[model samples]
Target: MKVAIVHDELVRRGGAEQVVLDMHKAYPEADIFTLCYNKDKTYEEFKKARIFTSWFQYLGKSEKLIKILYFPFAILAMRMFNLKGYDVVLISTTHCGKFVRVDKNASVITYCHTPFRLAWRPFSYAIVNSSNMIIRNIFLFASRVLRVFDSMAAKASDFYLTNSKEVKARIEDSYHPEQPVSIINPAAKLDNFYISNEVKDYHLVVSRLEDYKMVDLVVKAFNQTPEKKLVIVGTGSMEAELKALAGDNITFLKAQSAAQLAKLYANCKALIFPQHEDYGITPLEAAASGRPVIAFGKGGVTETMVPYNGDSARCTSVFFEEQTVESLSAAIEKAEMLQFSPGFIRNHANLFSASNFIAKLKTFVSRIYNLKTDTDFYMSLTEKVVYARKEVA
Candidate 1:
């Protein structure tokens, strides 16, 4: 079957980008369509795939520049892409790429990271956080206009899938699509991470330094606990401001290589996930590495993290009820007191491995296309045998 994969942009490597990579692995022949492609910023595997970019690719190759200067134009450009001959179009998007026009007969399955945050939430909570009043106002006005279009795009999809139940709830509340959204959890490379009994004194936060990520809150929480060290990995627009807010206990590191990241995950006391993510991969990665997680007690982390108080034998994390520094600091203190078994944590993480993701995704796609699998073939044989036995009786 001819398939095409569409995404918002290929400018940065994140959870959404990982989803696209997994989709490509599922359908190796599929061509990738996007508004922009920055080889330096994203995974190199994308370079192996046939990537088609819109006019926005040339206008502003940088994701930041494109969003600031020509976001509306980029949305329009996405709609203009020609995806004619493909039998199926799989869209991995948090924003406008879902609006890409495709053949009416083709099956368009949109794997939404979330309904565009700007359209569904308050201006301050939007995906693009900025201090500039002019830029913020422009996005606010644009989001108001885009809400209608975003709904139309949601309705246009043949199937809707989300990374977590949290996001599925968001979709129902925001878009109210005709069909129920399926939850397909994104996964980590389990093979790369192994349980390590030895750990460093420092805590770790592996996330983009964004407003919504609440990295600054983590920094502040660590700052208050002068004895505890916090190592932050990942860079974003908020890096400089976050660094300014950080105390001596907080150490900010730019994005690390996969090898370096694995080591960091293995060595840290626990992964500090302050943000409420759609379906957080970092927590799973940490668990897979036999490390505990200290997370905000909300969003996707609730689905993956077995809280210490709830499941002592298999617990991989402790939670903070609120997003405040006090709550987080309290959680950290609690985490210090708790003991988690590395074997148990690793076993919990194995439930969400990449192999399992691919298997489930393949089954989902087969059902959509009405394709028979080996399991289905065996079931049919069993049915035939039952019919023959009844006839003989």
Candidate 2:
């Protein structure tokens, strides 16, 4: 059967892009369709894929500029994506990629990262960081207009899958679709991470330095506690402002290579995840490195983090109920005091490995398409052979 994958844009190697990579891994033969592609910003593996881009590809490789100037065109481009010959179309999106026009007979499966965050909560969205009122207002108005199209596109899909229960709830509330949404957690490359018992004195915050990510809040929290050092690893629009806010104890590093990141994850006292992510992969990455997480006790982190109280040995994280600096500071203190088993943390992370994600995704797709996967065929053969032997006996 012919399968096609649709993604919003190949802009950067973020969590959404990682999901697309996994989707490609699950169906290597599937052709990828997107609005734009920036070879410099994305993974090299994409160069080998059968990627079809829209008319917007001529708009240049600057994703930030394209997003600001040509968002409406991007939406139009997504609607224009032709998926005629494909039997199944898997759409990976946080927005309008799911709107790709497909044949009436084709089955379309949408794996939503979240129902357009800007449309649902404009204030908390990334546009909040914009200093210019004119630009922010334009985005706000555009978001409201796009929301209608987003809901319509959602209704068109045959099946809905989301990265987390939080996003699943958002999808139901936003679209109110007739079909039920399934939860499939996005995964980390487990082989890339390593566990280490000798943790260093500093806490680590590995996230985009965005307003909604609240890396600034983590910086503020660390600023108050001079005894503890905080290492922030990521680059974003908020980098300059966040650096100004940080104290001497805080260090901001540009995005690191995979090996450097893994080493940092393995040695940090705990991974500080300050944002309410849709479905965070960083916490899982840290856990795979046998490090504990200290995260805001909301959103997708709640699903991943096994919070430590006095009694639970299985806990992989410590939670801060509020998003304020005070709450985060207290949580950090508690995290520092508590002890977590490295083996248990690594084992918990293994549950969300890339291999497991691919297996689950293949099973879900096979069921939806009413086709036998390789595993299913092998299992059937084994069963038939065993039955024949028993009958002969």
Candidate 3:
């Protein structure tokens, strides 16, 4: 069957982009469709695919400018896509990519990372950090209009999939999806990561330095504790501002390749995740390296990390109750005190392998399209579910 993949944009790399890459791997022949495509800014692997871009790609040369123009142009640009002949259109989006018009015969399978945050939550970081009152007002007005467009787009999909139950619940409450949302947590590249016997004193934070991510709070937490070291691996608009806020002990590295990141993950004392994400892939990567996490105790991180609940041996993470510097610092201190089993943590991570994710995704597509199943893969998954239930009983 002919397949096409649609994504919001390809301006920068993130968990959403990784999902698109994974989908491309599953459907190697699938052509990619998007609002914008930046060959320099995104993954190099995308160069292998036949990428179709909307007019938004010509709007700007800089990623910053592209992002600024995105919201206004996204819906219209996605609607302009001519995805007529494909048998399956797999939409991977947080925003307007779902607005793409497809043939009635084709099945639209949407993997919603999250509903558009700005559209649903107007007083969010985007509005507050706009700086210009006129721009903020324009954005606020646009959000109200986009919310309606977003809902209409949601209705176009034949099936829904998401990264976490957190996002699954959000999709149901926000879009009121016709079909039940399937949770397929994004996987870690287990082949690239491994545990190290010699761990260093430093902690790690691997995220885009965005306002909503709360990286500044982490910098503050580490600033107060000069004895602790932090290695931040990412670049964004806030890079300069975050560097100014960070102390001498904090080391900032531009985003590394997966192999380099594996080394960082294995050697770090723990990974610090401050954002309330849909489902964080970094924490899982850290777990794959057998390192524990120090995280804000909310959002999807809670679902992934095995938090300390009187048993240090069983936990793979330490959660801070609040987003404050004091709370996060305390969690960091608590994490240092805890003794966790590296082998056990790696075992937990093995359940969310890339192969497993692809298996589930293939099964979903097969079932949806009424195609023949891979009997061995299907039976293995069924047996595991049944065994899990038996364990609970």
Taken over the whole model, the C-alpha lDDT of each candidate is: 0.82, 0.82, 0.84
Ten residues in sequence with the least summed lDDT for candidate 3: 384-393
Q: Rank the candidate models, highest lDDT first.
A: 3, 1, 2
Cα lDDT of model 3 by residue, 215-273, tens digit: 99999999998988999999888999999989999999997887899999999999999
Which is the leading candidate under TM-score? 2
Q: Candidate 2 clashing pairs?
A: none
Error of 3 at 221 (Å): 1.8
Off by more than 4 A, model 1: 69-71, 124-139, 371-393
Q: How far is candidate 2 from the true structure (C-alpha RMSD, Å)?
A: 8.8
Show the colliding residue pairs in model 1: none
Off by more than 4 A, model 2: 126-141, 371-393
lDDT of 2 by residue, 1-393 (tens): 789999988978888888888889999999999988998899877998899998878875566756665557777777677778987889998876876787665667888888887777777754456548988878788778878767666666767888888889888999775567898888888898999868898999998877778898988888788878999999988999999988999988997888999999999999999888878989999999999999998988888778887844589999999999899999988887776888898999999988888888888888877733455753442343334223322
Model 1 CA RMSD to the hidden true structure, in angstroms: 8.4
- Most lDDT-accurate candidate: 3
Superposed Cα deviation of residue 224, candidate 2 (Å): 1.7
Models ranked on TM-score: 2, 3, 1
